[model samples]
Target: MQLFAIGINYRTAPVALRERVVFPLEQIKSALQALNATWGSNGLSNPHAGLPAETAILSTCHRTEIYGAALTGNASSMQASMDAGYAQCAARWLSACRQIPFSELTPHLYTLPHSSAVRHVFRVASGLDSMVLGETQILGQLKAAARAALDAGALGAYLNRLFQHSFSAAKAVRGQTQIGAHSVSIASAAVRLAQRIFERLSSQRVLLIGAGSMIEVCAAHFAAQRPHALVIANRTIERSLKLAERTNGRAIALASLPARLHEFDIVVSCTASVLPIIGLGAVERALRARKRRPVLMVDLAMPRDIEAEVAQLQDVFLYTLDDLGAVVQKAHTQRQTAAIQAEAIIETRVERFMRWLDARRGAPAICKLHEEAHRLRSAALARAQQRLACGEDPKAVLEAFSYRLTHTLLHAPTRALTQAQDEERARLVQLFGISA
Candidate 1:
């Protein structure tokens, strides 16, 4: 099997297209299973019956990526075929699964095969490929993806090893380099943008929507400002309450947002909801209720917790992930040196992983070689046993066994050397490490 990756990310596609391919966290396992089923029969029976022997899907706000190993019997011989055939199949599968036009999606997709796939995953896990350089969240997201794939039975030996090494590479980069120095994550960027819109976060009423990791991070950042009041609203009251308790804030039902939207001066939302939770009409109502008081709204969700049209409001300031990208980019130059070091570390790990993968590909040949040796040894033992049974001298029987085993082991190589051309003979000699 050959490893490969196909996807579209912030650099290759906009949110409009990226959002279209998002496999929601709750849907990831099912989506992975579906992907496997699309390629081949699922379950324990005949796992390698399809093109995709292993697979994992990583869908975050900025990217939707699929990492997989194609079931090519002879991986080295089918490189060109696997590159085009597997990529096209994956692209079509994604298009069909997401109900997207193949033409529209293919233009933005990037298909990486073999070592390139390994290198790309390593860079991503190390945060060198993040919109915010050296950000650590993508590593967690990748771990979650691997876990999901494993649960779905879509993860195989190849991907399992790849992800583990990817994690190790990430840990090494973060520990050995200064890539995380002065890190500006999306959560912090949202806070920074809110600070710019409002004179002081301490005096503002902050409302956080959703109870996921992003919101939790945002809450921590905004909480550090000692906002006048912090409230977390979510569809799940228990989850919201837990997050609120951690941040020393209050929790409210998501349904209450429509009724109390005007209560907060700053609203930050990041949810998995497919549709906008806060619509333009809701914002308009909130604005009127507040008598056009300015509200700073930051949306960290992909489908967007806040509507795009809300940006048109005269007294409302709205920012999406794309808007926060610029704020995060400002810190990119500061970490360039660390990023360079991280890249070197990732390259080294990538080569190491490829070597392991190559060794793995030779496993069947190694198994066969061991089996042949065992057969020869057994056959030689049988002849020695027969001589012993015929009342031959024990020492003589042992000597005959040793001589036959040695001759048998050397017979193949001796015959090959005799039949080989001069160049081939030299190669065979070197292979056996035979002296002149």
Candidate 2:
């Protein structure tokens, strides 16, 4: 079996492309179901169908990736076919779902195989691959993705172990190094950007456009400055109210935004909406209402909640993910020493995982041994039953049954040793853990 990861990330693609491929949280389970139907899962499927037996997806603002394992025999042809199946399946599935042609998407795509894929995931889970250096949010995103895949019944032994190892490696990285110290989450980074545009958050009003975790984190950071007013707007007023209550902000319906938009000096949004919520015209009207007072707008959502054209309006500093990347890059230099230490720890953990995988190479032999032993057990049980039916001594029957079962189990190894050549005897002895 071969493990593989295929997708686009911040390093490989711009935000424009990344947004186009994002798998929304609500859609992840269904997507995994469809993927598993085409790509087999839990080693149950028609061999004729070409698909990975196990899979998981990690979709975030900065990336969208498919991690999969192809379950097939060790034959070279089978291995090659399994490899081709998943790599193409991932690319074609993503392209078809997003309505982007493969030619247009392939340039930004990256395919990592086997250990390379494992290491990539481990690094990502540890926040090493995040756009914002050492951010903790991506770790939560990773866990969410894993949970969704598990709920979808798409995660099997290979993927389950892979993610577990990645989580452990991440813990090791955090425990052994200061890579996370003073880490600037995208939310925190957004706050810093807003600070640059305005003199003080205490003097300004802030409007949060979503009640999601990212927006909540941003709300907490901005709330710390004790803004003149903090308001949360959501499709569901109750959800917004919950968020607003946490930050001591007021909750408003998303429908109220246009009429009340001009009241805020800063707007931050991160939502799962597929279309732009804040259109250019709405922002223009809000800008006019403010008499062109500058408003800092941060769009943290993948696929974006704010229209791109709004960034062109004078006195409106619109920041999307790309702009946030620039803001977070400054702190990347300070984490270099800690990052180096984290890499070393990850390398050691990865090597340990690889060694465990190597030990699993003996699994087929172990399976065969158990199968044969089971046959012996069934045969011995049948004989004991016949003796009981024949009215053999009840106590003596039990002793004979135990003796028969033990002898049957040991017979094959004993016979094989008796028939073995001198050179093969040592190997047989080691195989059975025999002292001689």
- Can you give the TM-score per candidate against the true fold? 0.93, 0.83
lDDT of 2 by residue, 1-436 (tens): 5577888998998888889999988899999888777554423354643347778899999999998876555435344664566666667778888999998898899888777888999999998988877777788888998899898988888888889999999998888899988677788888888888888888999999988888888889999989999999999999999988889999999998889999999999988899999999999999899998999999999998999999899889999998999888888988999999988888888888877766675688899988988988888889889999999998998899999898877887799999999889999999888788
List per-candidate RMSD values in Å.
2.6, 4.4
Which segments of candidate 1 are over 4 A away from where they belong? 41-50, 73-77, 419-427
Q: Write the per-residue lDDT of candidate 1 for residues 1-436, one digit (tens) a residue.
A: 6888889999998887888899887798888877777664322123233267789999999999999887666655446655546567678888998899999999999988789999999999999999999989999999999998998888989999999999999999999999999999999998888888888888999999999889999999999999999999999999999999999999999998999999999999988899999999999999999998999999889888788889999999988898899999998988999999999999899999999988988999999988998999999999999999999999999998999999998898899999999899999889999874
Top candidate when judged by lDDT against the true structure: 1
Give the range where candidate 1 is weakest over 10 consecutive residues by summed lDDT: 41-50
Number of the top-ranking candidate, with TM-score as the measure = 1
Off-target runs (Cα >4 Å) in candidate 2 are 40-51, 75-79, 370-436
The Cα local distance difference test for each model comes to 0.89, 0.85
